[model samples]
Target: MSVNPVVRISKVLSLLTVTLLVLAGVSACGTSSDSTQDTITIGASLSLKGDFSDSGLGLKKGYELWADNINKSGGLLGKQIKIDILDDGGTPAQVTTNINTLIHNHKDSLVLGEVITGLAIPGFETADRYGYAYISPGGLTGKITAAEKDDNKHNVFGISLPIKSYLSSFDQYVLSLPADQKPQTVAFMGSQSPFATQQLAFSKAEIGDKLKVVLDAGGSYPEETTDYTPMAQQVVNSKADIVVLGSGSSAEAGAFIKAFKQQHYNPKALIATGGPDEGKAFLDAVGGADTAEGVFVPNSGWYPQIKNYQNDVFTKSYVAKYGGTADEIASDTVQGYAAGQVLEQAVKKANSFDNAKLQDVLKSASFDTVQGPVQFDETDHTNKVAIPFLFQWLSGHLQAVYPANEAQANPEYPKKTW
Candidate 1:
């Protein structure tokens, strides 16, 4: 046995070769499951079909444009950028499933998801479970990200003005008026959904004695409610100096406003929160300037008059690419673009796609977007600063009329009485 030393050494070398081959094969197979180092992939769940399609489509287009532009700029970190998306039909349950599939089945690195607050809540949960950042373009209510008591909201951030912030801005607008010009009595009308409910509660707490509440018409109006005549009648009959439509679709808001006009209820100020208050659909539904004149809404990401160098460039390019003015682009469009901008900036700062590293950068940084400076509060993960302003419909154009410095046009108080 001692005379066979060379043969024994050759046998040991043969065993090492087989082991190395097996390990290499396993590594190759595992890498194939996720992706190669040649590209970075991100996924999202959107309400591409159903009641939320308008906002969802705008979001999709914004994301697509971002991806295209990044690829044109030679991509990120020397890798091509790819975005994968699924339609959730505006359902929270579906959004959960879509996000789960994207994480577990597709193994994506990050998710940009959901416009509706309800749907975005579950999306945030799913993204957290996967240990990825979930940035929302809409869904600004703090509750959506569990900012109250739960610490799980750290991975969720957004572009929409949070409920507290929006209410504060609205309250500031009311107080900005001279004592004689300000309305003494107001009514609150909105849907019973989480967003509207949270907004109303905050409004009451923030508004305090600044204005008297003469009517509380807000309730859980089902998404399917088409006729708002009863609610409109209630608001009009209250004879309040200001009537605030807390929540409704653009069409629903238009219906209620039309009914209010028909009833000859001419309040000094008319403001709305959702749908008819923010997007282009509101103008179309309310029959243009003739009917929508002097209406006010929280900026809600739709005002084209919020001027800045970045916003001006974005609006011009958006108009050129989409063949319409910046106003034609929904807030969701800008939101989607801003979300992408945030993601890009974070990735660039970290110089890698490692989720943990990206998270650290996002939590600690501020981004300059078309919407202005966007910084996430380190604790709540909700945006700490936003360019929220109150906008009014003047003639056929939307004009910013609050916060003094940001106002594009003076408010037309005591809108024409019917």
Candidate 2:
């Protein structure tokens, strides 16, 4: 009862077509539901209140701007990525609670925000426990990454430059000068914050035995120490040609400048590292920019024209949303936005959001973000490769002065005679 060869072939062809059609239907259905799979969650933790609010606020705005720009542009992976923000009121206790809350709230998957290094010190375990990828935008504590030698880190990524970011720049800046103008004797200053000691030590390691650090004094800058008469006089007596102030607050630098100026001893060079605003505040509090002429500091993001984080679209939308000019932006915002872009690219590359599928897709993830080229090291889930710029204060404004070609302005000394 064998069928004819032609009939048999016809039946086989029909079955093949039907099977292909069924697969097509299933794939189409999956495509239709991509909206569900495209959704990715990002997280943030920062001080919304208390002492560090100014920078914290800026960090928040940066994150929001990053998130807003992404969401407006149809999001990533064909789905809108939602940012889950938690304010940690500038206290370690609050930070711990917020991390726990975000991990619990997100139900397993998680993203990270700026938590003071000290506060986040204990929470890495929680992230490892939950399989969350954590990125820190602001904390530069070198230990964060160096600790990778231990088992606590796998998903932890630190976007900010290590605490040593400033040490080399300041050292190089001084040494780069003509040998005649180089600063062989300098002063290192910071108020007695818990982090201050480590910062000074880091700066000194670079100084080595080559430079003479005349004054390495610190005290609480937030309290009522109106006059810096003693500290200034120390700078004067030591005949320090340079001053490197590393206070987290400007008032500390202002006091040192005022006291030093009164003594009629202006050093050959002065450098500060509280970012741009801190430099300006120091100038404002200590008469004007004239006295603090020869200072350099690190700043946030690239200029808008460069189309970096301050790109045309991001700049326009950020100003419009925040109701202010876009001159000042935190690196955190750039980092936050970059994180979103990473998630988006990962989701799209995966072409499916089965979490497991997403993981495979992101393992080799890379993308062009507002900050620049972003990618992750598989062993360590951090955007470790992107660093910050060294800014110099010339005339009245802070400008990028490192990397040779990126020099927006050149270094100069007002009181330090050439």
Candidate 3:
């Protein structure tokens, strides 16, 4: 049965070649499977329509900037992350519907979304319903954070401005003032708004025996607001030096500030708790740094002072990749990026898309944002709090002036009481 030597050699070579082919095919499949598993899914709910459209679009772009950059870096946890977006059309009812769909579709996708706080409330509850961790990129209300402790708040989280807490924190400085400088009575004025409600809730909790609120005045939105002059005069007559604004960007606030100055009832402190937008717009609208000059615009961070912040990695890379000058964009974009980073971290830690697991990871999660380290409490998820920087209009820019440690520039007002 012995074959010729040449034939035997040929047969042996053919067997070796077939064995190698089988091994190569198996190796190729293993690589393909690994590649498939390396992908992670992230989702968002944005207001793509209705009022607040301009700001909503800006927020969407900000989130995209972070998500795209992270994916470019091959994503987190050895997985290439993908972001899925849904537009809520700026209606709470519509927002609720969108959330339903998002949770259904992304029951498996990690949610990285926000509703512009005032209008995006339904989407917030949606996160609560599905137990999916969603970072609200622009919504800042304490009620939302309080919801985290409720049975319905399992997946609710936000990286938005702490407008309420910052307001209360700012009042601490007001309370500590020497008795002579501190006002015996104060005024709380706000345009009628949900934002105002949060401001009031926070004030009730924090404003101590320092100043009494004499004039509890407010204006309705776009109506009953024929003029804010009367309200302004009332605030002036109350002899209150400290005025806590209710809403962040109330046109009435600017009008009141103007009226107060015109009547020569300058207050020692004009504290605004709205996002930087309201603060900037009001300061700019009031004209002459001297008119709204002595006032303080309270916010977490603005891009101009970001160079002094500890977030060099993101700030540098973001400014370089994004076309806008860092001076022009909100330093808040850094926080938006930090939120995205949190999502990345959760996914890596969870190692699976199980909503429960992701929720667990976000719970008790403590990590660094562009501003500072953020830790979520089991009962409360408000993370990353820093001293509110009071920006006084110095030169043409709103520069940080408080906490001497972070004073980028000197205060425009050494002291004032109108």
Greater TM-score among 2 and 3 belongs to 2
lDDT of 3 by residue, 1-418 (tens): 7889999899999999999988865543202223357676566666667544444555665667776777777766667766566777766677777667655645435666663554445666776565556666543566565544554455666654565655654666666566776667667777665556666557755773456777776433432254767666777788775777664443545677768767887676777654334434444567644565556666665435455334565656656866644444553355567677666666667775555766787776665556555556455555544446666655545667765577777654334533
Per-residue lDDT of 75 in model 1: 88
**Local distance difference test, per candidate?**
0.74, 0.59, 0.59
Model 1: how far residue 195 lies from native, Å? 1.9
Q: What does the lDDT read for residue 178 in candidate 1?
A: 86
Lowest summed lDDT across 10 adjacent residues in model 1 is found at: 27-36
- Per-candidate count of clashing residue pairs (backbone under 3 Å): 2, 2, 3
What ranges in model 2 sit over 4 Å off? 1-41, 106-109, 146-151, 191-199, 217-239, 249-265, 277-293, 299-301, 307-310, 346-364, 375-384, 414-418
Ranking by lDDT: 1, 3, 2
Residue 177 in model 2: shift from native, Å?
Answer: 1.3
Error of 1 at 411 (Å): 1.0
Candidate with maximal lDDT: 1
Q: Tens digits of per-residue lDDT for model 2 on 1-418? A: 9889999999999999999988865553212223346665555667677656555666676666766777777765455656666777767677667766766654424455563555455455455455555555543465555555476555555544455554566676666677676677877766554345455676677774668877766443432355656656766787877776665546666666667777687677666556344433445666765665656665333544455643677768776886544544444455555555555565578775444454465557666666566555566544446555666555655567775666676666534432
